[model samples]
Target chain A: GIQVEQSPPDLILQEGANSTLRCNFSDSVNNLQWFHQNPWGQLINLFYIPSGTKQNGRLSATTVATERYSLLYISSSQTTDSGVYFCAVENIDQAGTALIFGKGTTLSVSS
Target chain B: DTAVSQTPKYLVTQMGNDKSIKCEQNLGHDTMYWYKQDSKKFLKIMFSYNNKELIINETVPNRFSPKSPDKAHLNLHINSLELGDSAVYFCASSQVNPANTGELFFGEGSRLTVL
Candidate 1:
Protein backbone atom coordinates (compact mmCIF):
# COMPACT_ATOMS: atom_id res chain seq x y z
CA GLY A 1 0.00 0.00 0.00
CA ILE A 2 1.17 3.52 -0.75
CA GLN A 3 1.03 6.47 1.61
CA VAL A 4 0.05 10.04 0.70
CA GLU A 5 0.84 12.93 3.02
CA GLN A 6 -0.22 16.57 2.63
CA SER A 7 1.52 19.48 4.31
CA PRO A 8 0.23 22.56 6.14
CA PRO A 9 -2.89 20.69 7.24
CA ASP A 10 -4.60 24.03 7.85
CA LEU A 11 -4.19 27.34 6.03
CA ILE A 12 -5.82 30.76 6.12
CA LEU A 13 -5.21 33.72 3.84
CA GLN A 14 -6.64 37.04 2.68
CA GLU A 15 -8.72 37.09 -0.49
CA GLY A 16 -5.90 38.42 -2.62
CA ALA A 17 -3.10 36.30 -1.16
CA ASN A 18 -1.44 33.32 -2.76
CA SER A 19 -0.67 29.87 -1.41
CA THR A 20 0.96 26.58 -2.28
CA LEU A 21 0.00 23.09 -1.10
CA ARG A 22 2.30 20.09 -1.15
CA CYS A 23 1.66 16.36 -1.45
CA ASN A 24 4.21 13.58 -0.94
CA PHE A 25 3.64 9.91 -1.72
CA SER A 26 5.61 6.87 -0.56
CA ASP A 27 5.61 4.99 -3.90
CA SER A 28 5.71 5.46 -7.63
CA VAL A 29 2.29 6.39 -9.07
CA ASN A 30 0.71 5.93 -12.45
CA ASN A 31 -2.18 8.31 -11.74
CA LEU A 32 -2.34 11.46 -9.65
CA GLN A 33 -5.20 13.93 -9.22
CA TRP A 34 -5.84 17.12 -7.29
CA PHE A 35 -9.36 17.92 -6.15
CA HIS A 36 -11.06 20.86 -4.50
CA GLN A 37 -13.99 20.22 -2.17
CA ASN A 38 -16.05 23.40 -2.11
CA PRO A 39 -17.70 24.79 1.00
CA TRP A 40 -20.94 23.16 -0.13
CA GLY A 41 -19.14 19.78 -0.11
CA GLN A 42 -18.98 19.29 -3.87
CA LEU A 43 -15.77 17.68 -5.09
CA ILE A 44 -14.34 19.42 -8.12
CA ASN A 45 -11.49 17.99 -10.15
CA LEU A 46 -8.62 20.45 -10.23
CA PHE A 47 -5.92 18.52 -12.07
CA TYR A 48 -4.89 15.07 -13.25
CA ILE A 49 -1.17 15.48 -13.49
CA PRO A 50 0.60 12.16 -13.17
CA SER A 51 3.71 14.03 -14.19
CA GLY A 52 4.80 17.36 -15.54
CA THR A 53 3.00 20.66 -14.96
CA LYS A 54 -0.42 22.07 -15.78
CA GLN A 55 -2.30 25.28 -15.12
CA ASN A 56 -5.96 26.31 -15.18
CA GLY A 57 -6.68 29.99 -14.73
CA ARG A 58 -5.41 31.09 -11.31
CA LEU A 59 -4.57 27.52 -10.29
CA SER A 60 -1.52 25.50 -11.32
CA ALA A 61 -0.03 22.12 -10.39
CA THR A 62 3.30 20.41 -10.88
CA THR A 63 4.15 16.80 -10.27
CA VAL A 64 7.68 15.43 -10.07
CA ALA A 65 7.01 11.72 -10.29
CA THR A 66 10.65 10.88 -9.81
CA GLU A 67 10.60 12.79 -6.56
CA ARG A 68 7.27 11.29 -5.48
CA TYR A 69 5.76 14.69 -4.75
CA SER A 70 3.47 17.36 -6.22
CA LEU A 71 2.76 21.03 -5.62
CA LEU A 72 -0.46 22.96 -6.17
CA TYR A 73 -0.41 26.75 -6.39
CA ILE A 74 -3.32 29.14 -6.07
CA SER A 75 -2.67 32.69 -7.16
CA SER A 76 -4.69 35.65 -5.89
CA SER A 77 -7.12 33.35 -4.17
CA GLN A 78 -10.81 34.20 -3.78
CA THR A 79 -13.33 33.55 -1.06
CA THR A 80 -15.01 30.93 -3.26
CA ASP A 81 -11.75 28.97 -3.18
CA SER A 82 -12.05 28.38 0.54
CA GLY A 83 -12.35 24.63 1.11
CA VAL A 84 -10.29 21.43 1.25
CA TYR A 85 -7.62 20.48 -1.30
CA PHE A 86 -6.88 16.80 -1.74
CA CYS A 87 -4.18 14.90 -3.60
CA ALA A 88 -4.85 11.31 -4.57
CA VAL A 89 -2.54 8.80 -6.23
CA GLU A 90 -2.73 5.31 -7.66
CA ASN A 91 0.51 3.43 -7.13
CA ILE A 92 2.13 1.93 -10.21
CA ASP A 93 3.03 -1.22 -8.25
CA GLN A 94 -0.42 -1.79 -6.87
CA ALA A 95 -2.87 -4.21 -8.46
CA GLY A 96 -6.01 -2.19 -7.93
CA THR A 97 -6.30 1.27 -9.45
CA ALA A 98 -7.88 2.82 -6.38
CA LEU A 99 -6.50 6.29 -5.68
CA ILE A 100 -5.17 6.69 -2.17
CA PHE A 101 -5.89 10.19 -0.87
CA GLY A 102 -3.94 12.42 1.46
CA LYS A 103 -5.53 13.86 4.58
CA GLY A 104 -5.92 17.15 2.64
CA THR A 105 -5.05 20.80 3.29
CA THR A 106 -7.89 22.92 4.57
CA LEU A 107 -7.87 26.40 3.05
CA SER A 108 -9.84 29.35 4.31
CA VAL A 109 -9.82 32.52 2.24
CA SER A 110 -11.38 35.50 4.03
CA SER A 111 -12.55 38.55 2.19
CA ASP B 1 -26.30 17.30 -17.69
CA THR B 2 -24.27 16.15 -14.70
CA ALA B 3 -21.48 13.75 -15.60
CA VAL B 4 -21.91 11.78 -12.43
CA SER B 5 -24.97 11.80 -10.18
CA GLN B 6 -25.99 10.06 -6.96
CA THR B 7 -29.47 9.95 -5.53
CA PRO B 8 -30.76 10.71 -2.09
CA LYS B 9 -28.35 13.65 -1.78
CA TYR B 10 -29.02 13.41 1.94
CA LEU B 11 -30.27 10.54 4.06
CA VAL B 12 -31.16 10.18 7.73
CA THR B 13 -31.86 6.86 9.34
CA GLN B 14 -31.87 5.02 12.61
CA MET B 15 -29.51 2.26 13.69
CA GLY B 16 -30.12 -1.25 12.31
CA ASN B 17 -31.87 0.21 9.28
CA ASP B 18 -31.09 -0.66 5.67
CA LYS B 19 -30.45 1.98 3.06
CA SER B 20 -29.05 2.24 -0.44
CA ILE B 21 -27.45 4.97 -2.48
CA LYS B 22 -27.66 4.80 -6.26
CA CYS B 23 -25.04 6.17 -8.67
CA GLU B 24 -25.10 6.68 -12.41
CA GLN B 25 -22.51 8.09 -14.82
CA ASN B 26 -23.15 9.49 -18.27
CA LEU B 27 -19.49 9.96 -19.22
CA GLY B 28 -19.37 6.48 -20.79
CA HIS B 29 -16.55 5.50 -18.46
CA ASP B 30 -15.57 1.90 -17.84
CA THR B 31 -14.63 2.14 -14.19
CA MET B 32 -16.75 3.39 -11.27
CA TYR B 33 -15.92 3.78 -7.60
CA TRP B 34 -17.45 4.49 -4.20
CA TYR B 35 -15.54 6.65 -1.72
CA LYS B 36 -16.31 7.52 1.86
CA GLN B 37 -15.50 10.90 3.36
CA ASP B 38 -15.57 11.02 7.12
CA SER B 39 -16.61 13.95 9.27
CA LYS B 40 -13.02 15.17 9.34
CA LYS B 41 -13.11 15.25 5.51
CA PHE B 42 -10.71 12.34 5.13
CA LEU B 43 -11.68 10.46 1.97
CA LYS B 44 -10.98 6.75 1.38
CA ILE B 45 -11.88 4.33 -1.37
CA MET B 46 -14.47 1.78 -0.38
CA PHE B 47 -14.99 -0.11 -3.63
CA SER B 48 -14.08 -0.05 -7.32
CA TYR B 49 -15.87 -1.71 -10.21
CA ASN B 50 -14.73 -1.92 -13.81
CA ASN B 51 -17.30 -2.68 -16.49
CA LYS B 52 -19.76 -4.24 -14.05
CA GLU B 53 -17.12 -6.45 -12.44
CA LEU B 54 -15.72 -5.94 -9.00
CA ILE B 55 -12.02 -5.05 -9.02
CA ILE B 56 -11.16 -3.54 -5.66
CA ASN B 57 -12.81 -4.13 -2.32
CA GLU B 58 -11.25 -2.42 0.66
CA THR B 59 -11.62 -3.52 4.30
CA VAL B 60 -15.21 -2.33 4.37
CA PRO B 61 -17.62 -4.14 6.62
CA ASN B 62 -19.84 -6.92 5.28
CA ARG B 63 -22.79 -4.66 5.89
CA PHE B 64 -21.56 -2.48 3.07
CA SER B 65 -22.09 -4.06 -0.35
CA PRO B 66 -21.56 -2.45 -3.76
CA LYS B 67 -23.53 -3.58 -6.77
CA SER B 68 -22.86 -2.59 -10.33
CA PRO B 69 -25.82 -3.40 -12.54
CA ASP B 70 -24.04 -2.20 -15.67
CA LYS B 71 -20.94 -0.39 -16.74
CA ALA B 72 -22.69 2.94 -16.33
CA HIS B 73 -24.19 2.37 -12.90
CA LEU B 74 -22.90 1.43 -9.44
CA ASN B 75 -24.93 1.37 -6.26
CA LEU B 76 -24.06 0.88 -2.60
CA HIS B 77 -26.29 -0.83 -0.03
CA ILE B 78 -25.63 -0.80 3.66
CA ASN B 79 -27.43 -2.86 6.28
CA SER B 80 -27.55 -2.65 10.07
CA LEU B 81 -26.13 0.85 9.90
CA GLU B 82 -24.23 2.11 12.90
CA LEU B 83 -23.15 5.53 14.04
CA GLY B 84 -19.80 4.98 12.37
CA ASP B 85 -21.62 4.48 9.07
CA SER B 86 -22.53 8.16 9.04
CA ALA B 87 -20.43 9.88 6.40
CA VAL B 88 -20.57 11.41 2.95
CA TYR B 89 -20.53 8.67 0.33
CA PHE B 90 -19.24 9.85 -3.02
CA CYS B 91 -19.73 8.20 -6.40
CA ALA B 92 -17.00 8.59 -8.99
CA SER B 93 -16.23 7.27 -12.48
CA SER B 94 -13.26 7.16 -14.83
CA GLN B 95 -12.09 5.56 -18.05
CA VAL B 96 -8.99 3.35 -17.81
CA ASN B 97 -6.64 3.10 -20.73
CA PRO B 98 -3.12 1.78 -21.36
CA ALA B 99 -1.65 5.17 -22.07
CA ASN B 100 -3.21 7.02 -19.19
CA THR B 101 -5.52 6.26 -16.29
CA GLY B 102 -8.54 8.50 -16.72
CA GLU B 103 -9.30 11.35 -14.34
CA LEU B 104 -12.12 10.74 -11.89
CA PHE B 105 -15.38 12.72 -11.85
CA PHE B 106 -17.11 12.76 -8.50
CA GLY B 107 -20.79 13.26 -7.86
CA GLU B 108 -22.19 15.88 -5.51
CA GLY B 109 -21.97 13.27 -2.75
CA SER B 110 -24.71 11.65 -0.63
CA ARG B 111 -24.60 12.65 3.00
CA LEU B 112 -25.90 9.96 5.37
CA THR B 113 -26.65 10.58 9.01
CA VAL B 114 -27.35 7.71 11.39
CA LEU B 115 -29.35 8.31 14.52
Candidate 2:
Protein backbone atom coordinates (compact mmCIF):
# COMPACT_ATOMS: atom_id res chain seq x y z
CA GLY A 1 0.00 0.00 0.00
CA ILE A 2 1.14 3.52 -0.79
CA GLN A 3 1.26 6.15 1.90
CA VAL A 4 0.06 9.72 1.34
CA GLU A 5 0.91 12.46 3.79
CA GLN A 6 -0.34 16.03 3.82
CA SER A 7 1.35 19.00 5.41
CA PRO A 8 0.03 21.71 7.76
CA PRO A 9 -2.77 19.59 9.18
CA ASP A 10 -4.46 22.78 10.32
CA LEU A 11 -4.63 26.16 8.59
CA ILE A 12 -6.36 29.48 9.14
CA LEU A 13 -6.60 32.27 6.61
CA GLN A 14 -8.14 35.71 6.38
CA GLU A 15 -10.49 36.66 3.59
CA GLY A 16 -7.71 37.95 1.37
CA ALA A 17 -4.84 35.72 2.33
CA ASN A 18 -3.00 33.16 0.24
CA SER A 19 -1.92 29.66 1.23
CA THR A 20 -0.36 26.53 -0.15
CA LEU A 21 -1.25 22.93 0.79
CA ARG A 22 1.15 20.13 0.10
CA CYS A 23 0.89 16.35 -0.27
CA ASN A 24 3.76 13.90 -0.31
CA PHE A 25 3.52 10.30 -1.43
CA SER A 26 5.79 7.44 -0.50
CA ASP A 27 5.73 5.71 -3.89
CA SER A 28 5.09 6.30 -7.57
CA VAL A 29 1.45 6.97 -8.40
CA ASN A 30 -0.45 6.76 -11.62
CA ASN A 31 -3.01 9.42 -10.71
CA LEU A 32 -3.48 12.25 -8.26
CA GLN A 33 -6.50 14.39 -7.45
CA TRP A 34 -7.27 17.30 -5.18
CA PHE A 35 -10.64 17.41 -3.44
CA HIS A 36 -12.37 19.94 -1.27
CA GLN A 37 -14.87 18.70 1.29
CA ASN A 38 -17.16 21.70 1.57
CA PRO A 39 -19.08 22.70 4.69
CA TRP A 40 -22.02 20.73 3.37
CA GLY A 41 -19.90 17.56 3.30
CA GLN A 42 -19.92 17.43 -0.46
CA LEU A 43 -16.64 16.20 -1.87
CA ILE A 44 -15.92 18.51 -4.76
CA ASN A 45 -13.25 17.56 -7.26
CA LEU A 46 -10.80 20.43 -7.46
CA PHE A 47 -8.23 19.15 -9.87
CA TYR A 48 -6.98 16.00 -11.65
CA ILE A 49 -3.40 17.12 -12.21
CA PRO A 50 -1.34 13.96 -11.96
CA SER A 51 1.94 15.68 -12.81
CA GLY A 52 1.44 19.27 -13.85
CA THR A 53 -0.05 22.58 -12.87
CA LYS A 54 -3.68 23.62 -13.22
CA GLN A 55 -5.51 26.76 -12.20
CA ASN A 56 -9.21 26.98 -11.45
CA GLY A 57 -10.29 30.43 -10.42
CA ARG A 58 -8.92 31.11 -6.95
CA LEU A 59 -7.60 27.57 -6.70
CA SER A 60 -4.60 26.00 -8.40
CA ALA A 61 -2.58 22.78 -8.02
CA THR A 62 0.83 21.50 -9.05
CA THR A 63 2.03 17.91 -8.94
CA VAL A 64 5.70 17.02 -9.19
CA ALA A 65 5.58 13.28 -9.70
CA THR A 66 9.33 13.00 -10.05
CA GLU A 67 9.62 14.25 -6.49
CA ARG A 68 6.54 12.37 -5.30
CA TYR A 69 4.81 15.49 -4.08
CA SER A 70 1.98 17.87 -4.99
CA LEU A 71 0.89 21.36 -4.04
CA LEU A 72 -2.43 23.19 -3.91
CA TYR A 73 -2.66 26.97 -3.85
CA ILE A 74 -5.53 29.03 -2.60
CA SER A 75 -5.14 32.68 -3.42
CA SER A 76 -7.22 35.23 -1.55
CA SER A 77 -9.22 32.66 0.30
CA GLN A 78 -12.91 33.04 0.96
CA THR A 79 -15.26 31.98 3.71
CA THR A 80 -16.74 29.47 1.34
CA ASP A 81 -13.36 27.76 0.96
CA SER A 82 -13.30 26.77 4.61
CA GLY A 83 -13.25 22.99 4.72
CA VAL A 84 -10.97 19.98 4.45
CA TYR A 85 -8.73 19.64 1.41
CA PHE A 86 -7.74 16.08 0.60
CA CYS A 87 -5.09 14.80 -1.77
CA ALA A 88 -5.78 11.30 -3.07
CA VAL A 89 -3.39 9.23 -5.09
CA GLU A 90 -3.57 6.04 -7.18
CA ASN A 91 -0.34 4.13 -7.03
CA ILE A 92 1.21 1.36 -9.14
CA ASP A 93 0.28 -1.24 -6.56
CA GLN A 94 -3.42 -0.87 -7.21
CA ALA A 95 -3.35 -0.52 -10.97
CA GLY A 96 -5.14 2.82 -10.68
CA THR A 97 -8.21 1.31 -9.05
CA ALA A 98 -8.60 2.93 -5.65
CA LEU A 99 -7.44 6.23 -4.25
CA ILE A 100 -5.32 6.42 -1.12
CA PHE A 101 -6.30 9.66 0.62
CA GLY A 102 -4.17 11.73 2.89
CA LYS A 103 -5.32 12.87 6.31
CA GLY A 104 -6.15 16.20 4.69
CA THR A 105 -5.42 19.85 5.41
CA THR A 106 -8.18 21.45 7.42
CA LEU A 107 -8.53 25.02 6.14
CA SER A 108 -10.52 27.63 7.97
CA VAL A 109 -11.20 30.92 6.23
CA SER A 110 -12.42 33.76 8.38
CA SER A 111 -14.11 36.98 7.41
CA ASP B 1 -28.67 14.88 -12.55
CA THR B 2 -26.33 13.85 -9.79
CA ALA B 3 -23.45 11.79 -11.09
CA VAL B 4 -23.34 9.79 -7.88
CA SER B 5 -26.22 9.39 -5.42
CA GLN B 6 -26.35 7.56 -2.07
CA THR B 7 -29.32 6.72 0.06
CA PRO B 8 -29.83 7.24 3.80
CA LYS B 9 -27.74 10.35 4.18
CA TYR B 10 -27.62 9.52 7.89
CA LEU B 11 -27.89 6.30 9.82
CA VAL B 12 -28.12 5.71 13.55
CA THR B 13 -27.97 2.16 14.81
CA GLN B 14 -27.17 0.33 17.99
CA MET B 15 -24.20 -1.96 18.39
CA GLY B 16 -24.66 -5.55 17.22
CA ASN B 17 -27.18 -4.38 14.66
CA ASP B 18 -27.04 -4.59 10.90
CA LYS B 19 -27.39 -1.88 8.29
CA SER B 20 -26.86 -1.18 4.66
CA ILE B 21 -25.97 1.83 2.53
CA LYS B 22 -26.98 1.97 -1.07
CA CYS B 23 -25.17 3.81 -3.85
CA GLU B 24 -26.02 4.39 -7.45
CA GLN B 25 -24.14 6.19 -10.20
CA ASN B 26 -25.47 7.56 -13.44
CA LEU B 27 -22.20 8.71 -14.95
CA GLY B 28 -21.92 5.56 -17.06
CA HIS B 29 -18.75 4.63 -15.25
CA ASP B 30 -17.63 1.06 -14.85
CA THR B 31 -15.88 1.49 -11.53
CA MET B 32 -17.40 2.29 -8.13
CA TYR B 33 -15.64 2.68 -4.79
CA TRP B 34 -16.53 2.71 -1.10
CA TYR B 35 -14.54 4.92 1.23
CA LYS B 36 -14.81 5.61 4.94
CA GLN B 37 -13.89 8.90 6.53
CA ASP B 38 -13.07 8.69 10.20
CA SER B 39 -13.67 11.27 12.90
CA LYS B 40 -10.28 12.86 12.29
CA LYS B 41 -11.29 13.23 8.63
CA PHE B 42 -8.93 10.62 7.23
CA LEU B 43 -10.51 8.82 4.30
CA LYS B 44 -9.61 5.17 3.59
CA ILE B 45 -10.58 2.85 0.83
CA MET B 46 -12.91 0.04 1.94
CA PHE B 47 -13.87 -1.59 -1.29
CA SER B 48 -13.65 -1.19 -5.04
CA TYR B 49 -15.89 -2.69 -7.71
CA ASN B 50 -15.45 -2.66 -11.47
CA ASN B 51 -18.18 -3.77 -13.83
CA LYS B 52 -19.97 -5.44 -10.95
CA GLU B 53 -16.87 -7.37 -9.90
CA LEU B 54 -14.92 -6.82 -6.74
CA ILE B 55 -11.43 -5.61 -7.53
CA ILE B 56 -9.93 -4.23 -4.35
CA ASN B 57 -10.83 -4.97 -0.78
CA GLU B 58 -8.53 -3.35 1.71
CA THR B 59 -7.92 -4.84 5.15
CA VAL B 60 -11.56 -4.05 5.87
CA PRO B 61 -13.17 -6.53 8.26
CA ASN B 62 -15.14 -9.41 6.84
CA ARG B 63 -18.24 -8.02 8.52
CA PHE B 64 -18.42 -5.49 5.70
CA SER B 65 -19.55 -6.62 2.27
CA PRO B 66 -20.11 -4.82 -1.02
CA LYS B 67 -22.53 -5.96 -3.66
CA SER B 68 -22.85 -4.61 -7.17
CA PRO B 69 -25.88 -5.97 -8.91
CA ASP B 70 -25.20 -3.96 -12.04
CA LYS B 71 -22.74 -1.53 -13.48
CA ALA B 72 -24.59 1.44 -12.00
CA HIS B 73 -25.20 0.27 -8.43
CA LEU B 74 -23.02 -0.75 -5.52
CA ASN B 75 -24.46 -1.31 -2.06
CA LEU B 76 -22.64 -1.99 1.18
CA HIS B 77 -23.81 -4.19 4.01
CA ILE B 78 -22.37 -4.21 7.48
CA ASN B 79 -23.12 -6.91 10.03
CA SER B 80 -22.80 -6.70 13.80
CA LEU B 81 -21.94 -3.05 13.65
CA GLU B 82 -19.76 -1.70 16.40
CA LEU B 83 -19.10 1.69 17.90
CA GLY B 84 -15.86 1.76 15.94
CA ASP B 85 -17.89 1.62 12.76
CA SER B 86 -19.11 5.14 13.29
CA ALA B 87 -17.89 7.23 10.39
CA VAL B 88 -18.88 8.93 7.20
CA TYR B 89 -19.28 6.57 4.28
CA PHE B 90 -18.67 7.92 0.80
CA CYS B 91 -19.49 6.30 -2.50
CA ALA B 92 -17.62 7.42 -5.56
CA SER B 93 -17.56 6.47 -9.23
CA SER B 94 -15.10 7.04 -12.02
CA GLN B 95 -14.45 5.95 -15.56
CA VAL B 96 -12.33 2.82 -15.82
CA ASN B 97 -9.83 3.85 -18.49
CA PRO B 98 -6.35 4.72 -17.29
CA ALA B 99 -6.50 7.80 -19.49
CA ASN B 100 -9.56 8.86 -17.49
CA THR B 101 -7.06 10.03 -14.87
CA GLY B 102 -8.92 8.24 -12.04
CA GLU B 103 -11.03 11.28 -11.42
CA LEU B 104 -13.80 10.34 -8.96
CA PHE B 105 -17.17 11.96 -8.38
CA PHE B 106 -18.29 11.40 -4.80
CA GLY B 107 -21.68 11.32 -3.19
CA GLU B 108 -22.86 13.45 -0.31
CA GLY B 109 -21.41 11.21 2.38
CA SER B 110 -23.65 9.08 4.56
CA ARG B 111 -22.95 9.72 8.21
CA LEU B 112 -23.37 6.56 10.26
CA THR B 113 -23.40 6.39 14.02
CA VAL B 114 -23.07 3.01 15.67
CA LEU B 115 -24.05 3.66 19.25
- Model 2 lDDT per residue over A63-90, tens place: 9999999999999899999999999998
TM-score of chain B of each: 0.97, 0.96
Q: Per-residue CA lDDT of candidate 2, range B1-115, in tens?
A: 8889999999999999999999999988989999999988889989999899999998999999999999999999999999999999999999876456578999998999998
| TM-score for candidate 1, residues paired by index | 0.98
Chain B of candidate 2 vs. true chain B, TM: 0.96
lDDT of 1 at B110: 99
- lDDT tens digits by residue: candidate 1, B1-115: 9999999999999999999999999999989999999999999999999889998999999999999999999999999999999999999999885435579999999999999
Which ranges of candidate 1 are over 4 A from the true structure?
none
Q: State model 1's lDDT.
A: 0.95
lDDT of 2 at B60: 96
Global Cα lDDT for candidate 2: 0.93
